[model samples]
Target: MSKIKIMKKFNFIIQSKGGAGKSFFTYLLGIKHEQNKETLFIDVDGSTSTSTNQLKFLEDQKRIGVIDLLDSQDRIARDRLFGSIEEIAELSYSNYILDFGAPESEQLPALFSRDVNQQELKGFAEFLNSEFIFHVIIAGGTAYGACMQYLTDIVRVVGEEFKIVVWMNENTLLNYPKQVEQILEAANALGLDVERFGDVLSGSVFDTKLSTIIQQGLGKAGIMKSGYMIQTQMKKLTAEIII
Candidate 1:
């Protein structure tokens, strides 16, 4: 039998609005990739180190390494960000997951639009022999419009060679099913891949309970250990995502 090909790719989770579940999705993706590959988790979100904190459990295992691009003022050092990308490009053997803060949604797309940055990103993809996929989360309720606009902006900047994945957050889906449908339609119209994330149970008692676990730094594993229901939900959600 012919050997099945293992696809290698870099996944970037970026969104303009805070509380849109960027870190949560990154955590889920990390769990999905942990078993089979040596993955590098880059926490570019200077404003909040949620992803980095969540993945701390892997540090002892040497499964991941982090690059802190933030200065004392909690701002991203542009030069350092560029330099780090170059450095990471050299480590072509491992997969990468980059979690960008809300502000970076604007900055990164602008950077990617530049001819120089575009060439660098394309070169990295080639050098690493991997595909680059941008994961944008579109949540329901008040954040929906801003999230969709961010998605549009990303589509405008990124070239056709790159793939875009739209993740629909289920927390507010019940309250905004029509909006969810609209976003799905828009994503389909743009030829982007779409997936539904399990409900995070935000703004509820259960969410409050989960928050306590998260604050303790156990991250996704904490949630998984919480109960079988959450585990099943997470499994279903992550299973649909193609690395």
Candidate 2:
């Protein structure tokens, strides 16, 4: 495998709410960095395995490793999971996008909140900050309130070391044209630095022409067009991402 070019860059496509396009965006982020830099797309969402499927091509080609977190079961599985996480922390010198499963995200804060054993997770975050620039990708939708709360939960757990990027996934404009305002309000209330977050992006994957063309069997040509459309969307989103 090629060495990662950016050492301190970590992107976690996180959202407690499902159907928010986390996996799709994860695939796009991987594509954005795959060609020019060392990129590792870790699929931690074992339930849906959406990212795992989307990035299967990369895994098959040996360009990425899609880890199905659901596969981590039993004591042995948990041990392996811990080992893998530690190994990544130790050996990761490339850009990484961890598609955190909803169950894991929901459990993480609680797991890390305990007084006695929280040091492990805190240490993990510290290792990330010391070794890589950490980032959180918040996927939001019509449920704007839930989105804000999710962001708050993440910030509370991870602290202020990481930059946040919010994706307006569903009914983006129709639901909240002034979504940024809502975010700002929430940030102010929570005492989070608004400057620490990046601009929001429209992350809708279903409204594209590709989704329509696929039903008509437009084949490779339609697929190519959809790919271009997705690329354009990803370019805009990544451009505003805080390093």
True-structure RMSD, every candidate: 3.9, 5.8
- Each model's TM-score, in the order given? 0.82, 0.68
Clashes of each: 0, 3
* Residue pairs in candidate 1 whose N, alpha carbon or C atoms collide under 3 angstroms: none
For residues 42-113, write the lDDT of model 2, one tens digit per residue: 777767666666654465445555554434341114444456666665554566668777765555554435
How does each model score on lDDT?
0.73, 0.53
Model 1: per-residue lDDT, tens digit, 67-185? Answer: 77655765555577657766876674457788888876656666666533555766666765667888898888898888999899888877566888998888766689799789879
Runs in model 2 lying further than 4 Å from the true structure: 1-8, 68-82, 90-93, 115-122, 125-141, 160-173, 188-206, 211-243
* Candidate 1: segments with Cα more than 4 A from true spot: 1-8, 68-82, 115-120, 203-206, 219-225
Q: Which candidate number maximizes TM-score?
A: 1
Q: Candidate 1 — worst ten consecutive residues by lDDT sum?
A: 210-219
